[model samples]
Target: MILVGAVVVLLCWLLGFWLLWHIPAPGEFRRRAGRAPAALAVPESIPLSVSVVIPARNEERNLPCLLQSLAEQTRKPDEVIVVDDHSEDATAAVAARLGARVVRAPDLPSGWMGKPWACWVGANAATGSLLVFLDADTTLSPEGLENLVAEYRVQGGMLSVQPYHVTLRAYEQVAAGLNITLMMGMNVFTPLGDRLAPSGAFGPCVVCSRADYFATGGHKAVRSAILEDSFLGRVFA
Candidate 1:
């Protein structure tokens, strides 16, 4: 019985190591370091038009910070649209106060989720070559939008960013397990990363070409999906 238990323990250890080995480190993606202004400058070429779309449902408290961060971006979006998804709060008012175009999302239709529907409304109203979808709670760095644009230009497909979480409450720390599991399960830490399955996207921040978004039917294709972001990633891929 002792020998059998030892063998079982060894197998478990080997399995754990194998799983860890396949996971990819976040640093491997070269996400840091924005391109220099000089390197980013071009000779009188028309810059790509980018529109930011935010879906808000009772996001009155979060909108202000996110909008402020967006306003400070090195590469500003041509337009910012916020879709108020039937929020009883001042979500629309807050967005308007911050100079964002606000669209009141229509009542939820049959077989549709709130977020995807709101996003679809925003996407339809956007008039830019690139569409950046951001969650209301997300705050960006000054160079965040610039980096996203640069990365998209190079990658020429959907780009999703897993925002660095900032926790203030003790309970928030407990979410680390879920975060780690998500990364590992989605193969974000694996050698193939998103390429292997195109199975995951950071719901807080997603960027893609307007044409590509529409070509994949935007959020409409995933209207009822609870995991709309992940479904969209697969569609874009």
Candidate 2:
């Protein structure tokens, strides 16, 4: 029994040591990113029109907060459109009341999911040079839209950002598990980072030029995908 216990302890110690040595600390990722390329840099004076497109289904309660945040933005959207995905709730009414143009998402096609279809419809309707696709539940900070546009002006490509989630109640704290799972799924902190092609993108918030969106085929390219964000990211890559 003593010999068997000794062997188990040795194995566990080795496994722990292996993981400790290989997993990356999140901050280390910034160090790994080298200088930006000259080709990606754009002049500061360039002007681009921005549109905020939100796809919603049964989000009447949450939609107002987002629109309110949008209204409070230091850098306003040229236009804000909400795509109502056949919600039983009063989503369209609430959106129009809050000063957002409401558009009805057409019926789900044979090959597309609700979100991607709504997004596709919204994109086609948008008149801006830049498109910001944001989830209905998300609320931006005052400088949020400005910062996004500024960053896009510098980098000039599809940009994805993970929103910091806040839990208002103890019960909501259980959502930390999903947060942990997402960090682990990123593969950035693991040995698999080099071997696997990264498809990890924050689907809840994304910004890109309308031209790049169309060039990559946009959401329509990944219409039938179960995880359309991953597929769309892969397509853009």
Candidate 3:
């Protein structure tokens, strides 16, 4: 009995060691990304028009950074729409102050999740060839829009970026780290590429063509899905 107990403890210790050793530290990721050039001009022939959509839900604290980021983007979006998703805070005020067209979303539908429903409202109001869905908490670099547009125009399909997620608290740090690992491991790099399998984006920076969005039925088709980003990607595929 003693021998069996000893072996079990040893096995547990080994398992714990393996798990700890493989868990990537935050520093392992290349967080220090240089900002893309501010003036990344698209070819004049295409004349791609872009609509930037931001969904805010009680995000008064984070809205300023995002607005500033949008203002600084080298390739300005033709339209910027901010959908206040039943926010009790001053989200609409902040967005309107930044010159974004603020739309107040009605109460969420029974089957839809918060963010996706908000996105649905914004998408319906957008009038650009390209639609960019950004989260309220995310801050963009000055050239980020230009870079994404260049990639989307070239690729001509859905494109997403793994933005540098910043967190202040310890729990937030751990969650962010785990989220990164899951994304990298789940083969999300090419969600709509050669792999016909379904995958999801982080939802912070989802960029896709307006044509492709409607072709995939848009968020209305994925109303029931809690993870609408994954549903949209599969529908596009």
Q: Quick one: how many clashes does candidate 3 have? A: 0
List model 1 lDDT by residue over 107-186, tens digit each: 89999999999999999999998899999999999999998887666556788887888989999988877766566556
Clashes of each: 3, 0, 0
Pick by TM-score: 1 or 3, better one: 1
Order of models, best lDDT first: 1, 2, 3
lDDT string, candidate 2, 1-72, tens digits: 999999999997775454333543323332344424333344555678999999999999999999999999
lDDT of 3: 0.75
Off by over 4 Å in 2: 1-33, 36-40, 187-197
What is the C-alpha local distance difference test score of each model?
Answer: 0.82, 0.81, 0.75
**Model 2 weakest 10-residue run by lDDT:** 26-35
The parts of candidate 3 lying over 4 Å away from their true place are 1-44, 188-198
By TM-score, the best candidate is: 1
Candidate 2 clashing pairs?
A: none
Per-residue lDDT tens digits for candidate 3, residues 52-151, read 9998899889889998888899998899999999888898998899899999999988988888889999998999989999988888889888877876
